[model samples]
Structure formats: structure tokens, C-alpha cells
Target: MGFLLLAGAITAEVAATTAMKYSDGFSKIGPSLLTLLGYVLSFALLAQTLKTVSIGTAYAIWAGVGTAAVATIGVTFLGEGLTVTKAAGIALIIVGVVVLNLGGAH
Candidate 1:
């Protein structure tokens, strides 16, 4: 359940970040409201996960996964260019998160 909540938090954060691009600096009412709502829900869900999960582990996974997902979304759907360097950076983020979790376990 904790992991599930963490996943929800990551998802909400990614949604919020993606919607922010469409918010037009908060000048657009609809997407702006969506961005705000998504962030609120994301933090709320993350708080729930903290009840059972270690903050270090939960946050590493949340930020890392959210970042990777958002980067992918940007490249795939937002016409952002995907370069070899960007791919390597994403891979490094994933590996770093895994290493953090493994280190935290001991």
C-alpha cells in the first residue's frame, strides 16, 4: 500500500508538471487550475506514503521516476528532441534511484 501510494504521488506530480506546460504561466484558467489540483493531490498522496516508507527511499523513487516519465513525455508528445545525452541522463537517474534504495536497506 505504501508503494502504491508512492506511485500515485509520482503519477500526480508528472500530471501536474505536464499540465504546467499548458498553463501558459498560469494565465490560462483551466490548465492552471489542473496544475494546482494535481500538485495538491500529489503531495497529499506522498504524505500518505511517508507513514510507512522511509523518506529517503520514497522521495528518491518519486523524484527519479517522475522526472524520467516527464522527460519521456516531453520528448514523445511535446516535440522535444531526444538526444543520446538525454537518454543517458535518464538512465543514470534510474540507476541512481535504485542505488539509493539499495543503500538505504542496509
Candidate 2:
């Protein structure tokens, strides 16, 4: 559940950041509203995860995974080009997150 909440938080935060790009200096209503809602939900989910997860581990994984996820989201849904280097970078991030979690358990 803690990991689930963390994933949700990361997803929401990515959505919020993407929406912010479309908000056009806050001139667009739909994107602006989405940005606000996404951020609010992201923080709420993150806070909930803190109830069970260690703060340092949670924060590190959250940041690492969230960054990769957001980059994927941008490339896939936002029509941003995906370069080979970027793909490798995302893979590395996933590996790092796994290693971090594994080390934390010991």
C-alpha cells in the first residue's frame, strides 16, 4: 500500500507538471485546473505513504522513479521525441531504485 501510494503520488505529480506546460501562463482554464488538482492529489498521496514507509527511502525512490516516469509520460503522451540515451537513462533509474530498496531492506 505504501508503494502503491508512492506510485500514485508520482503519477499525479507528473500529470500536474505536464498540465502546467499546457496551462500557458495560467491562461487556459482546463489545464490550469488540472495542474492544481494533480498537485493537490500528489501531495495527499505522498503524505499517506509516509505513514508506513521510511522517509529517506520513500523520498529517494519517489524522486528517482517519478523523474523517469515523468520523462516517459512527456515522450509518449506529449509527443516529445524519445532518444536512445533517454531510454537508457530511464532504465538506469529503475535499476537504481531497485537497488536502493534492496539495500534498505538489509
Candidate 3:
């Protein structure tokens, strides 16, 4: 299903981004390679989902949700500090993603 593919892409992207953070300026070979492979699979899955999903809606959900998730991981797992402004920004992105899903019925 399109949802499955999209979810896979999002998961892959999150994993890729997390590894990229641990890549240590690309000094770590395993994480670096994992990042590249994850991205490749992510894009491939995204392309498959585009066959059925509308481009604008799909892209907005994909990017908006992915951004929020990655930022959350950065703040929580990666020890990345979060300022008030950044938190508010990520909250807005989550709102946008919820709105996009709600509009699916229209």
C-alpha cells in the first residue's frame, strides 16, 4: 500500500539522518555507508508511493512529518539542545502534517 511505502521511506530517512549524525564528519565508515544505503532505499520507496498518491499532498506529509521526527530524535537521542524557537517551529510542522492528513478526505 501507499501508506506502507511512505512509512518505510520516513523510517529510512530517520535512520539515515540519525546515522549521519553519528558519522563523525564521515569518519565512521559503517554509519556513513548505512546513511547512503538508507537514503537510497528511502527515495526508492517514496517514488513508488508517488505512483498513487498526489504529488503535493504526499510530499508535504513526507517532508513535514520527516522533519518533525528527525528533529525530535536529534533533541532526545543525539543530545542536541532545543531552544524555544526551535521547539515552536517543530510544533508548527507537526500541526501542518496533521492538517494535511485531515484534508485527505476532501
Best by lDDT: 1
lDDT of 3 by residue, 1-106 (tens): 8878988998998899889988998999999999999999999999998998877877887788889999999899878999999899999999987887897721
lDDT accuracy of residue 8 in candidate 2: 93
Candidate 2 per-residue lDDT, tens place, 1-106, comes to: 9989998998898889889989999999999999999999999999999999988878878788878988988898889899999999999999988998888741
**Clash count for each candidate, listed in order shown:** 0, 0, 0
Pairwise lDDT winner, candidates 1 and 3: 1
What is the per-residue lDDT of model 1 for residues 1-106, given as tens digits with 9 covering 90 to 100?
A: 9999999999999999999999999999999999999999999999999999988788889999999999999999999999999999999999998888778641
Q: Least lDDT summed over 10 consecutive residues: which range in candidate 2? A: 97-106
lDDT of each: 0.93, 0.89, 0.88
**Which of candidates 1 and 2 is the stronger one according to TM-score?**
1
Give the TM-scores of the predictions, in the order they appear: 0.93, 0.85, 0.92
Positional deviation of residue 102's Cα in model 2 after best superposition, in angstroms: 1.6
Candidate 2 stretches greater than 4 Å from native: none
